[model samples]
Target: MSIPATESDTATRALEVLRRLTARDDATFHEGQLEAISALVDEHRRALVVQRTGWGKSAVYFIATSLLRAQGAGPTLLVSPLIALMRDQVAAAERAGVRAVAINSANAHEWDDVRARLAADDVDVLLVSPERLTNPRFREEQLPELRQRTGLLVVDEAHCISDWGHDFRPDYRRLADLVDSMPEGVPVLATTATANARVVTDVAEQLGGDVLTLRGSLARTSLRLGCLTLPTSRERLGWLLDHLTDLPGSGIIYTLTVSAAEDTARLLAEAGHAVSAYTGRTDPDERVRLEEALKTNELKALVATSALGMGFDKPDLGFVVHLGAPSSPVAYYQQVGRAGRATESADVLLLPGHEDADIWHYFATASMPSPSKAAAVLGALGTEPLSTTALETRVDIRRTPLELLLKVLDVDGSVRRVQGGWVATGQPWEYDEERYERIAAAREAEQEAMLAYERGGTCRMELLQRQLDDPTAEPCGRCDVCAGPWYPTEARADSVAAATGALDRVGVPVEPRAQWPQGADRLGVDVRGKIPPGERPETGRVVARLTDLGWGGPLRELFAPGVPDGPVSDELLTASARSLRDWPWAERPVGVVVMPSVSRPQLVTSLAEGIARLGRLPLLGRLDLADGAPDQTSGGNSAYRLAGVWGRFAVGPELAASVAETTGPLLLVDDLVDSRWTLTVAARELRLAGADAVLPFALAAVG
Candidate 1:
């Protein structure tokens, strides 16, 4: 049995823990922090702390951990959200004289050693990502013993646990189960700088039993928030070029998309700013280096997507500027909270884009799974293991939503993963239509609220606080609404031109699919492993990615659902011609052929004909699709995609004769290239027909 600490004993020990953590004699808790710490240390009660950034929430946990361990309790277990957060927490814990270890994707090689340390009681805190909780090996081999010894379980960025939260994560929902399983009277804490009243209530209920909820004024005194709506991407990039250096200390420039982040960073660098881009595509090792660079002020700014959003700690960050609006005010608050953490006066500016809603819609739909798709996935899975790509071939679901559904199913006990791939446990799974509907409705409301935030006349900071249900919400007198406009609306003409040029620049590499996807032979093509170099198309070129900052806008408009397919526009034709001329190749194509487009035939035909006419090459005749052939490029797994388009395309008699006659490489043009299976199968047909080589080209490609 554990004895409670006296108030005086808890106070003195808390001060000691703070001093060890900050190495400052004057360190002390702000407002309710001490009470939260005391509740854990003295009363052994669960608590949830909702406070603003820079309010020292991490201090509460570190101090509480130190005191708990001093009383002979076991190590703290932290379920953090990102690699960056884990790194910071481990370092913070060590600095405070608490030995710490983290087991995540980046440090897999150290897992055995770390597990030994934990079992031997050599570690004081262990930080793991939320995803690790669902791993079969970890769950069966390590978790049970780990849980028995865990002194206090901490869930950082607690809002993620709530389905209503702006950044809802399916894995975080597993915490509710963990909380219920913990030994009675062992304390737990959930901390987040974000979270509205609803999110707080939701997370608190998930925490189980009676939880002491301490909510604080969600105000960051250092932030001077404001919004500036831009009419175009060019103006937004130009503004950054003109005004980036004027901002105070090192900070982050947040963008709604990965391409925008990269484009902004590149333009800023060309104009002599020290900046780097951080996105989901960045390598894990590189992300660590970039975070350190920002913390050390080595880079003036890191242009980033929300990959850097939750649990990133950089006190004294000077500013945070958004290139476009996030879909929710709650998310916006969490991001802007990264700034003005330890200093007085940090500028927070939102440059909302006209195209933001379309991006929002695209991302939102990618997560919410349709019922039919979910059923197909379940029907396809059995005791046999199948990879994500395999499931795609069988189910109509795309990669993103399929993976999200898998996670949802795994947490719900409907499916379990094995070493080979994923296997269904033969458990019944319900669609949870009512819950999904509520979640969908909540998302739409958040989007509208975010839009209102940009259009609202009230104090920007106060508006945000009110959205989070902060009763103490009041005008901070620091934003544009409270004070006069502090930023310029106009950018220099030359800078605007530069920005436009950057956005206008087109052409991205289309690397050939080197190896045939696993299990493709069963699709009836008989091709396996590496394609013979002679049969494969050379590395190709696309006018641009549909997701590119330069071409994404026009391409999105062209491909948006229900848009009638038509001939390529004059400007796009000119751009396509330029792409052909700019493409660097070992040898120029001697002729051209068009791939049949089930969805955009006119666009494909007109563009191919126009190009062949200009280049003075024969339009060798089109690859004809057999009637009823499935549209391969739409979406599907590799094998089925191959199966759909495999025997679907054949060289027409004239095209076969022309290919046999051509002694040189031929170019294949299409409206778009997504999976590349359409091109691959078509090229294979041409190769068998005696074309010397095939060089594939598309107006746009999906990354």
Candidate 2:
């Protein structure tokens, strides 16, 4: 079979590239993969690829890059979202004979070397985070040159470009700026596996006019989907204890929070299962090891937050079990799609929690910056770059929300981040109230759909496909809904008890603040350097983190907004007892002093009284709120939190006189520990008074 003369060289080169990439004598494109490669390499046309997970989407870009580089084009620019995904992609690309390098937060030290490689034309592809675009140093120093020479612009997880996407990034929306500045005939490719019709349309529009959109059926026949509506966290944990080993191979156990992932992994490990916790806060090196452990089947599962989502490549993953539902159906489908990629069958189960809706609300509301907050952030920035900590002093917003709002402002051209910190660009900015409201509506709708998926009326797979707007969606006849439940419904009492025992084990190290936040002096706090070891409080105890499995559910309910603040619940008191029993404190307290929780006075006082009664200690008195000072708000960045409470509390003469007679350490109790600044400030007052030590205790700790 000789090639015809009319054929282009790109197609022949694509074939050769595919063979080398796969290391197979006989390797062929999967469905539309070849067409996408040809469009970028041969026709120099932009393309959008929407396919199911494990459909070889990465192959298209890798093959196209190989062909283009050989044709004398410059390196491809790939912007990915997740660090874990980026590491996996770099490894995969290297295995395929492509030289890929990345500049991300995880590998800051190697960026200079990577940049050097890029300049030498020795790198076939260069990857970065979308957040890198808003960086003024990168934007002014590197991006212009790279943009001029980039052969192809690849947005991997392209659905993130649209706010309508389940996992949208404010930074991803900045791709429109990159697209607008691209050189003529420099082809672009956007790829995603979990986009609905709306997201597809939004992404295609960003890729510019005359873009070719290639979408395939979003169906994975190898996946046997099921949903178990477990009534309680205990039941869900019990089911996992009983059935995890029965799953065919290693996979993932998805959790909604980092604490959940950590707790789940700890429980599984205690039960003699080889499991690892993968969360956003996990050290980069540890995350890599965990990912490798899963890939090599050395571990049964990686208990994970959505931090593990987007680009992990595990072809033979046997199952994916969700302890709580994600906020949307498309997001759920994308996660479950990780399994059954190369195998005959894989189990996919969703165990929805009663708190799933509340968790969803927390995340959803967190990402959206109120118009006033956004304006305040912009106003806070100046020509002189301000670090995030400095900006926190100028704006009342908390860390997570402030970071998100800054990114949104950067995308809107109202701010720029330089070497030192972020600066205002002085560009006119609009609130776009209508747009924000529209996205909020979409989120609510998606949330409702997710809840419906849990309720389970139609084929589970069919419902997910429809949520993705798959035209070919139909009854798969392989899901619990269509074929009836294929998983166990009952969990033994012993298993449940074991899980409960793990959850009930409560005590967290209250690491003392080693150094005061820089710039605190401007806020009227004169403290700096390590608090003299003598002034620091003893290690404290909290009932549990609000995200823990055992006590997290009830504590969240108790603290739910609009619920009246009252006395300590018996469970909390018992949990506190566990903390007291386990305390490695040098000596028990002789008296109890209450920190005035203006927002929760009754709860705080009751918790202190309960501890005093349990210890047979005297209830000294409460720290008085400064005259005319408002009760402090709960949420803010560390700097603002400290500023808000710095001068707001005073140890009145009555409390000082009462504490003088007390012996040994004094128990300092509060309803919640958020910033720990409150505890630190209160302890400083107590230590100044005559108390030998101040041991802080709280009902819950919030991260």
Candidate 2, residues 1-703, lDDT tens digits: the string is 2232237676677777778888886877677887898889879998999999989898899989988888899999999988778888898788678899998888889988988998889999999999888777789999999999999999999999998988889999989889889999999999999999999999999889799998999999999999998788888998999999998899999999999899889988989999999998988888788888999999999999988877677999999999999999988998998899889999999999988888898888888868888788888888998998888778777778888888888888898778888999889789888988999999999999998888888888889889999999999999999999999998999999998788778887677676787667777778776788777798898888888887877888888889997888877887887888898999988888998875778888888888888878899999888755633577766666777777677888989998787778988998888888888888888888878899998888885
Best by lDDT: 2
lDDT of 1 by residue, 1-703 (tens): 1223344788878877878888888776678888898899889898999999778788888888989998999999889998888888888888888888999999999999998898788988899999999887888888898889889999999999998888788899999999888988789999998889899999999998889999889988888888888778888888889998889999999998887888888889988999999999999889988998999999999999999977477887999999889988889999999998779889999999878888888777777766777778889999998888777667756567788999888878878877767999899888888988898888899899898889858888898899899999999888898996888878888888999998988777777777886766655667778877777787787888876777878987887779998888988888888888888888889999998887889999999998898888999999988757655756576766777777888888999888888888999998788888878888888888898888898889875
Clashes of each: 2, 0
The superposed Cα distance between candidate 1 and the true structure at residue 229, in angstroms, equals 1.5
| Count of clashes in candidate 1 | 2
Ten-residue region with minimum lDDT total, candidate 1? 1-10
